[model samples]
Target: LQTIKNHLVEDMFASEGFRSDLFYDVQTRQNIVDVVKKNGKLKVNDATMTRCDLLNTNGVIHVINKVLLPDHHIED
Candidate 1:
């Protein structure tokens, strides 16, 4: 369950386009993922982001189609 919760990022996308190779998740502060907007679509790592910037009182929400496991958490 903790792995799932770490998928939520601490930052919010305030614009329609952005790119970063060092975005940290809510948990596992040492873990990082890249966020990029390409061909008008948003992506996290190689996973496509189906939804972006769903706003709420707390923060923003973005949905991706694949599981983003931290490097240390991946099985060999």
Candidate 2:
């Protein structure tokens, strides 16, 4: 389960049309995505991006108002 979850999270790095690695949604489930599309803007979920792209020695960090999930409902 950990292996599969790891893969899912790895894939979620591209959901908002960019790369990300952090989620802090209070209402989102671990494997559920809440999409947001309004005013000609589209994001994977309604998550408000608080911060993004903080470079680190091992990787980058991103902060969002909601959690993210991989495309489980899409046919891949």
Candidate 3:
């Protein structure tokens, strides 16, 4: 799990869409980590999240889990 998280973080930083203010924000990073912990997955499809396809610049993909991840409010 730690490995996956690291990979995601690294990728995010390397991504062109990454914004220093948004991506490096401790609160936002912790929120994403919390979501992964509680739901065993990341809610990549969230409006606030960004996605991109390396193979196809014209397309993008979000990394979502089979199950919905809960937010800080515990809402599903």
Candidate closest to the true structure, highest TM-score? 1
Model 1 global lDDT (CA atoms, 0 to 1): 0.61
Error of 3 at 24 (Å): 10
The CA lDDT of each predicted structure is 0.61, 0.41, 0.33
Candidate 1 ranges beyond 4 A from true positions: 15-30, 72-76
Q: Which numbered prediction scores highest in lDDT against the true structure? A: 1
For residues 1-76, write the lDDT of model 2, one tens digit per residue: 5323422333334225532433322222245543343443334454454555555555555565544544432121
* Candidate 2: residue 49 Cα off by (Å): 1.2
Ranking by TM-score: 1, 2, 3
lDDT of 3 by residue, 1-76 (tens): 4334422432322234443323232233224432222222223323233343444354334544333233423334
RMSD per model, one decimal: 4.9, 9.2, 12.2
Off by over 4 Å in 2: 1-44, 69-76
Q: State TM-scores per candidate.
A: 0.65, 0.35, 0.21
Task: Please give the lDDT score at residue 17 for candidate 2.
Answer: 54
Off by over 4 Å in 3: 1-14, 23-58, 64-68, 73-76
